[model samples]
Target: MRRFVIGDIHGGLKGLQQVLNRCNLKEEDKVIFLGDYVDGWSESEKVIDYLITLNGNQNCVFLRGNHDDLLLNYLKTNQFNKEWFQHGGESTIEAYQKVDSKTIQNHIEFLESLQDYYIDEANRLFIHAGFTNLKGVEFEYFKPLFYWDRTLWECALALNLNLNRDSVYYPNRLKLYQEIYIGHTPVTRIGITIPHNIANVWNLDTGAAFKGPLTILDIDSKEFWQSDPLHTLYPNERGRN
Candidate 1:
């Protein structure tokens, strides 16, 4: 069984399919998604539909992301206007509008059910963003989990400002997790850099919603596979067809 982790899809259905094809995934293989499955592109409805079909399959695990959280909020209160519009949620709203009410509800349920973070028996962890080292905290705050980044979290820890933060701080250091696979921050390529004073985390967000490659990481072997997102997409036509 091949075990793999895919980075943020962000409405790039074509890129998603290409990465899956490149991986040669089989029924026995296990696949995990790091979130941000919607927004940025015009095909969020399609992505949700695809995920719906994958339900009940033991080979897949989809964790909640900040964008996914906004999507659910929109569904429930119809008031995710600001955050959604700011972060490429306009395209997602259009996609959802085209789908039926029932389908929209189902998709919302799926997004709401997603876990904030995932921890495996291998001591490896997967989260859309890093935590603030909050001790005894069973959950993470909403915005930072989706927006604020490493530097901010590290600074917050350094000054001992966040009284809620639980974990120990390593001065000019980053080793919070045994192994952490994260997305939410886009990079030019799959970042494997782990300097002495740097973090032991791997960032797989290859900017599928923009110009870079869409990446997938093999969990057990630590191998990588990627595909370009540009060639497969059409030029933006102002959200119209």
Candidate 2:
């Protein structure tokens, strides 16, 4: 069975579906989502619903991203925090306008059920965002770091260039996993629009939340696919500012 890992979806159901369609998946294929499933686009609730349906048909691992966490927290405590709202969270709120409470709750439960990180048998680590502590993979870093930190990506960018497998010069987090796949820090920020590899850590977030497309990669084969950029798909919609 082909094992596929996808980057941030960001409520762009079209992007999500497009990437999946390109995967040529079978019943036994495994799909791992790196999170940020909600926010940015106009179908956050629909995106979550589709994911719930996919769970029954495939081996799916859902990891929570910062946007997914914001929605969950808002649903649980009734606090729609301003910061979250400012950052594509409003689209998620809008997406729930006509959605039934039960379905919304199911979506909430799905979000709550998401894992922080997943490590496969091959030791390939899947995390929404890389950890903050460059010192090591130890849990000394805060939880938010796992969902939001860009330091690991930055470190990977540097270490990968030097080709330094040396533990002393490179960060310890690099050595902890055989290979790392992460989302959250969109590749668009670097002015590139495709998945990028730095050392063993691959950044799959092609920025579906902004102008880049959603990306899916085969862990074993290294084959990859991408949806049209969200802007191209949505046309007039202003995806994640």
Candidate 3:
């Protein structure tokens, strides 16, 4: 069965739907979603609802994202963080206003049940963000780093491609996995509107929260599909731009 890795959705349910349809997934195919499923668009609640139903019909793996964590905290405690609101949380809060308490509770449970990271039998590491430990994810001291860290990506970007893996300057963390797939930080930040690879780390976030399209990459073939830019799909909304 083929394996597909999807980037952040950021409440762009239309974009999500488009890419999934384009993929033409089979029942046995594995699908891995690198979080940020909510916030930025008008359908955050609907996105979560769709995913909950999708899980039953598909072989799916969902990773936790920082935005997802913030929403979960607000749902569970009724405490709001100002930073989260400024960074697209307002859209999520607005979307949830019409949702029933039972639905909200179910969403909360789904959020809580998300995995911090997943390592397949092929030795490919899939995480929402980066792990800080040089020894690898199992030795990560800070749990939040799994969904919050950018240092790992930064290191991958900064590395000289010519450097030998056995060299003293080679990053120990990069040696831990055959390949690492992540989202969280959008590749659009670097002016890339598609999945980008730095060393063995592949960044799939094409910034659907802003001006770019949602992306899904075939892990084996490296072929990919994208939806129309989120701005075009939801012209009335500003998204997180």
Candidate 4:
């Protein structure tokens, strides 16, 4: 069975469907989502619905992103979080509003069930953002760094390829895993429009939160599949501007 890891979706239902169709996932194949499933676009509820359906038919691992945490917090408190709204969550708010109370509760439960990170036997670590200060698989501290850190990627990107492996600082940074896959800070921030791999860390977030396409990377092969650019999929809409 093949393993596929998808990057941040940001409410691109069409893009999500396209990637899944392209993968043609079999029952034994596993799909890991790096999160940010909602917000940015107008079909947040639809995206949740589709994921819920997919869970019934496939082995899926869903990680919680910062945006998802905001939505869950709002659900528990029933208070309109301005920050959530500020981050293109207005569309998500509107989407949730259209659904019935029961459906909304179900969606909230699903979000709560999402994990902060995933580790496979192959030593690949999958997280929504990055990991910091985690001594081992069981980190005594639980923080949003799992879905918000960026310095890890920055460090990985800045490393000199010719530098001696023994001379590396913080070499044990993510010692628990042989490789890492993350989505949160889009690779576009570094002036690239596709997934970037550095020091075995793969940044699969191809900026679909704005202009790039949705990316899905094969865990073993490092091959990928992507949806159309977000703009082309939803013209006249600038998601999370």
Q: Could you tell me how far off, in angstroms, the CA of residue 175 lies in candidate 4 after the best superposition?
A: 3.6
TM-score to native of every candidate shown? 0.80, 0.95, 0.99, 0.94
lDDT, candidate 3, 1-241, per-residue tens: 9899999999999999999999988889999999999989999999999999999999999999999999999999988888899889999999988999999999999999999999999999999999988889999999999999999889998999999999999999999999999999988889899999988999999999999999999999999999999999999999984
Residue 121 shift from truth in candidate 2, angstroms:
0.7
What digit string (tens of lDDT, one per residue) describes model 4 on residues 39-150? 8977888998999999999999999998888888877787766777888788888788778989888998999999998888987888888866647435726577888788
Candidate 3: pairs in clash: none
In candidate 1, position 209 carries an lDDT of 67
* Candidate with the greatest TM-score versus the true structure: 3
lDDT for model 3 comes to 0.94
For residues 68-98, could you state the per-residue lDDT of candidate 1 as single tens digits?
8888888787787775696778888877777
Candidate 2 at residue 27, lDDT? 88
TM-score, prediction 4:
0.94
User: Which residue pairs in candidate 2 collide?
Assistant: none
Off by over 4 Å in 3: none
Candidate rank order under TM-score: 3, 2, 4, 1
lDDT of model number 4: 0.85
Candidate 1, backbone clash total: 4
